[model samples]
Target: MEYRKLKDQDQDGDTNEEDVESLRGKAISGVSLKPLAAFGVSSSDRSKWKRKTIVTFALTILTSSQAILIVWSKRAGKYEYSVTTANFMVETLKCALSLAALARIWKTEGVTEDNRLSTTLNEVIVYPIPAFLYLIKNLLQYYIFAYVNAPGYQILKNLNIISTGVLYRIILKRELSEIQWAAFVLLCAGCTTAQLNSNSDRVLETPVQGWIMAIVMALLSGFAGVYTEAIMKKRPSRNINVQNFWLYIFGMIFNAIAIVIQDFDAVANKGFFHGYSLITTLMILNHALSGIAVSMVMKYADNIVKVYSTSVAMLLTAVVSVFLFRFHLSLAFFLGSTVVSVSVYLHSIGKPRR
Candidate 1:
């Protein structure tokens, strides 16, 4: 009789313990049984997804609301003091506060020595790049705002979304669905409508240098988002408290450099120790709160969703700018903004439930 090893079966000829253990190990180790599935989400699921849908909707609303509030607070006239000097001061203070917050969290949580040092280095290296870029961006934005009004600035800034989307697709190989693409197009249309001939009355003949600087600023903001996302993914479980703590430390370093370069005289005249203007105070609070909000949201939500939420805020700002500032509101502006809003809504709808 040919002694064939009878397929590791039990006495009843069922699959034996060895076979069962092997299968379990594969599952436990993340070896998928289904080859065709993407991101481990099977196509067969239908009734199982109701909870995810509800949760995503709730999170989206929360994210959009927070963004709107932050934008409003930042744009409020009280926070719009002399843009360059005030922004540098605000960023410097924000960095200081953020580092303090991080240290408090670290002391409470008792991080490992290795983790502590790594976290410190993260802040040291990453914070300043974005801070300086953002300072420059804000400076250019205010310069533009001085000439063209808030509505125009809001419209132009929406172009950041376009740039971001392109970068994501090209650099990250993240693919968007057809609906998402349509949403982006609609957003562009809305922004165009919102800005079309909106600045006819007050053309300040803004220097080409300013326009270049503004575009650079917008690009930096987009790149910052991408870079932050990348960093978070690399260490998914890293505490936001620690990350933000380091962020502030590095931010302070860069902001200090910026202050010296841009506001040395202002600091000397006002006394470096007593430079707490009302605008600077609001900005510090704004940065601290907004940083926390953004870090938490990014932890739970998709990057694209976060980006789109800013679109909603931009739309609100455009509306507020027209009515509150009494800026021009032509038909083109209205139509474009409407299209962009619709696109944003559609994009929000199509976002995958986390």
Candidate 2:
């Protein structure tokens, strides 16, 4: 990812004395690069930081709003429409968007030898793997709301950070520092503390089934994220829109199959859009945008930025839930969220010194 000093090199691959002299003059005119270098900030690093900041902000908004909208979209305890159908619709939308972007690229860049292999099955076959994994993880997103409220879901979702770290190391052969390992332990303890309720007899508000589903969802999310990252990184030169198109194409296929298997009779009895409302439409848009945002994060930024953004969203969701859903902010929830926030910071900046 490092960029060489293009201005200092000529077409003949030799140093340009004129360019060096020009830079030297600029330095003489009170434009020294030493101050920036002193802080270890280069032009490339600044560019990267800017991109990461923008993507992190987008992720924070998309993630927090999506969680809130999902909870609000539910009527009573269940969704009137088929969850599988909804997921299928989201994937279809994403595929369309990615295709449109790819078409724009083709129009401007022209289809050449570089992208000729983009759509072939041999090149795109790995997409379906993460697509299927995402299908399961997304379905659980809707189903888990049945057991826990919005804030509780936000807190529990952090479990994926732990699972992601494990799979990221195991599958990608990356190394985590000892501090990051302790941060994972702290994250688990924070989630457990969030679930504690002094007023309830059972201690935890979420049922056993809810915990099971949450664990399964975390595992699926971790694996899908790591796998998708692997696929994207495999072809570092490939356009991300092409990758997104294939992934979403397979996502739509898998979700369609799920709809047929699980909701064929119900959809036949009513309709695909039978119980959909404005809230439902908004939820669909939120999910579609969220998926696109996550893909961009994986492509442009690393998962550490994603973790920080989602961690901020966790707090944002809890705050929004208080006014919208009348969610009580308990002492345990505060302490737990504080701990979770600390864990996230520690994990993000806990890398070993070079």
Candidate 3:
């Protein structure tokens, strides 16, 4: 009687019986996807989620392998190319591959001629900043290697997390909670403790210059890493291939300039691949792929994730060093490993309180 009375009161009411029944059923069933929607995830689709998982796994493997390969390649006695020269080779191939891929994408999707000029101009203006930063960081690594051992380099470079966190706040204007800051400090301390060398001879051999360079690299790398995250976030829809093509073009150009400046006549006298071998090519390809891999990580996530990735790679390198590279594993390594493990857990599980 009451329902009929209410229905009769609204003469032009358009909501039908079927709609009411469907909504009532939904309310009873508690069918809600708002939580998932908030995270930008679709609860309705499982396949897309699985694909993302696979990609992340692939990235982890690629990142870890790249770190090991770099150490193994450079220290090996037979590689003929100079470090900077080899870096030049890596950037060249990286740019070429990216350009080819971009061309394929453009041909398939069809480019807008009107936007071509703007795209070119933007690439010209913005892309080189990161590429030049890359050049500086790479050169610093070589200098660091000259002054210190691998362990020292890893320990010092891990400080990028602190710098990254600080800059992430300033540049992105996203504040970190006290807990997050504590976690970052814990992470740095743990990694540093873990890689501390016990042997005095190796320590004494590495001068203060290497230590200073490593710190400088850490600061610069943090800025570069955060800057990359900002770029991806600002243009989330930008084609990764197109952006990579521009970025690598500048990288190639800058690296070429570095090689020429370091040795003015080497290009004409001996050629780009002077004393190069199969190993050099493999190393170059591996490093190039790593560049792509890290960029993907930065695009999808943030520098914090990349920092953990480097930590994992560092741990793996330490293991490889112990078994194959004939490096000593000190007590600090075990303790530091434990601390770093805890830090990773803390960072993963700790949530910001509302």
Candidate closest to the true structure, highest lDDT = 2
| Best first by lDDT, ranked | 2, 3, 1
Local accuracy of candidate 3 as per-residue lDDT tens digits, 81-174: 4555665666666667656655555576666542121375654577677666766776666567677766555456666778887887888886
Identify the runs in model 1 with alpha carbons over 4 angstroms from their true place. Answer: 1-85, 92-128, 132-155, 200-217, 273-280, 318-334, 351-354
- In candidate 3, which residue ranges exceed 4 Å CA deviation? 1-56, 74-76, 112-123, 136-154, 200-214, 320-328
Q: What is the RMSD of candidate 3? A: 17.3
> Which 10-residue window in model 1 sums to the lowest lDDT?
7-16
- lDDT computed for candidate 3: 0.60
> Could you list the CA RMSD of all candidates, in the order they appear?
17.5, 11.7, 17.3
Clashes of 2: 0
**Judged by lDDT relative to the true structure, which candidate is superior, 1 or 3?**
3
User: What number of backbone clashes does candidate 3 have, counting pairs of residues 3 or more apart or in separate chains?
Assistant: 0
CA lDDT scores, all candidates in order: 0.50, 0.66, 0.60
User: What overall lDDT, based on C-alpha atoms, would model 1 receive against the true structure?
Assistant: 0.50
Q: After TM-score superposition, what is the CA distance of residue 168 in candidate 3 from its true location, in Å?
A: 1.6
**Lowest-scoring 10 consecutive residues by lDDT in candidate 2?**
7-16
Total clashing pairs for each candidate: 8, 0, 0
